[model samples]
Target: MMFGQTPVTHVGVDPFNPPNPDVWPATMAPVQQILREGLDLGPVTVFVGENGSGKSTLVEGIAMAYGVNSEGGSTGAMHHSRTTESDLHSGLKLTRNPGSSKYGYFLRAETMHGFFTYLADNPSMGRPDSDYHGMSHGESFLELILNRFRGGGLWILDEPESALSFSGCLSLLSVLTQLVDGGDSQVILSTHSPMLASLPGADIYEVGPWGLRPNVWEDLELVRNWRSFMDAPQRFLKYI
Candidate 1:
């Protein structure tokens, strides 16, 4: 409803052509387990999970399904430095809203450096007056959001907190809130930061052994763990 275009309404495993057993091991859990029920998306959706919980994998799949390059950036900016993408995208199905997306970007924190390098090599992509390479990682990241992210688009971010300071995270939260509230945009994010996940009315989903399910911000493990540690670090340290 926020994005004039139907934001991606639902997402689920395609459930066709079962993957090869040898290539994709049974021991390695697939996102299909978590997405079997099909996930209904909100204007702002946040995926939270521990490392290797398939949050990044799922976000990349969604981005690919939406036609963004596997590495990052928009559809037109195709630069693949490596082939680390999972097969999930091919097996993923997306139900989009009626109208088409006018703008879209896949911002992967892990790959932003490589993407920026690609942009620098190809000046035709419209190089900013101040080179992104010259700026700090956090500064460049903020620059990208402030400049490149023209509202009225779909945005997918993976571990954006990696390059952000606590204050930077707050700034990003403010920027994202403005985007969703004022502009016609839908955002899906995979993060470990409770701060980022606490985006007012965002739909927070926890990915774990039980799979992805709606979760409350206060109930998040990240929040709980941080709160416990901050409340009494000495207690946790004493155990160690």
Candidate 2:
């Protein structure tokens, strides 16, 4: 079967030690309610929202629920973690087909470097040249995505555009679009980049004060505003 459509049949937190109650974004309550409704059947799914709107929190919750690592495999620089082991979220329920896999990869911003290092050391994945390996942050970002993401499995990426230049984001988009077209891999990404959100057939869900809701990247008011402002910065800047 194709990815994403394999309906998620259960949701739960680690019982021994759970996520912190304090770190749960005020927006999470509703988002959790909606996720409990149903999983998207589309090929590529995306979550977009403001910085603190709980997009990552919800994504991590989904990963934990599915038994995927919170870090998504690659480990590099450690950033401040919001959820402690003792933290917890309840009221989760299952609603679909059940299955399990041996491989699931979660990619976060800081882990990109580590991902590449592992790839370089492991020839089975792909062997990128030193120039590609040592390229700027954006180049390395593209290289890792191209090399590491080449199979049928569950992949979750949070804020992938952090290191990518606009062109690099476009490159990642091309790769993802092609991967989805192949009909084997499934990916859920949390990002704010319009370029990334605009991938064809991507189910874009916005998480914010109102919680998660079906959305179109082009319909986001912020996208339009940013496009307009960037189009004529001098025009908008004079007012400021």
Candidate 3:
């Protein structure tokens, strides 16, 4: 890796000898496909899936295999509070682009609070202190990316829409676009938000019982569902 960039070309678990056959992700069709044929990553990859479809698990495993902290943070982060993650990472393998970055960061909205505490507990040297806990959830996310996401590296985010508004997601999209445009960075994001899935120049994958299949943003089931709901809220609302 060239000082800063971590472009992973492939990720997969052992097809014949998985970490656990009866486990959740192992039983998922998408993950099973990955086990058979390791997933290939692009400069920017977006995964849209229904809940419990194994998309998050796949992203987590990939990030973990790339050496990012499981709980969330940079590659060297050791902020572990619990072992809630599955055993997928233990059996996953990553193939990085030769001379790209080896370091990266994992940002999952659900773990941001703990990650913030970790940063607070172990302050970096010679940097101005910014209290992440004091900022709004969206503000903190943008701030963290602005400060830490620079130069070149892989940035993996899981369901960041939990903390971001429409504009906030747009801001994140801009930053991510710039990162990839810098010529040595890459991004892998998983989200249910159609806005996030519509990131320009991103390769979108729809994960479901059918497995991980590529599609354009407009053709994604996620996009169509959101569009339908928006077009007729009562159609969905009346059922509820």
- Superposed Cα RMSD, model 1: 2.4
All candidates: CA RMSD (Å):
2.4, 4.9, 2.8
lDDT by residue for model 1 (68-128), tens: 8888787677788989888767766888777656467889889988988877776644644
Better of 1 and 3 by TM-score: 3
User: Candidate 1's C-alpha lDDT?
Assistant: 0.80
TM-score of each: 0.90, 0.72, 0.93
lDDT of 2 at 17: 42
Residue by residue across 118-227, what tens digits does model 2's lDDT show?
Answer: 55565443644344457888876666677667755556788988988888888888877766666655667888788888878777887777656787777975578789
- State, as a TM-score between 0 and 1, how close model 2 is to the true structure: 0.72
Highest TM-score model number: 3
Off by over 4 Å in 1: 1-6, 15-30, 124-130
Please list the C-alpha lDDT of all candidates, in the order they appear: 0.80, 0.62, 0.85
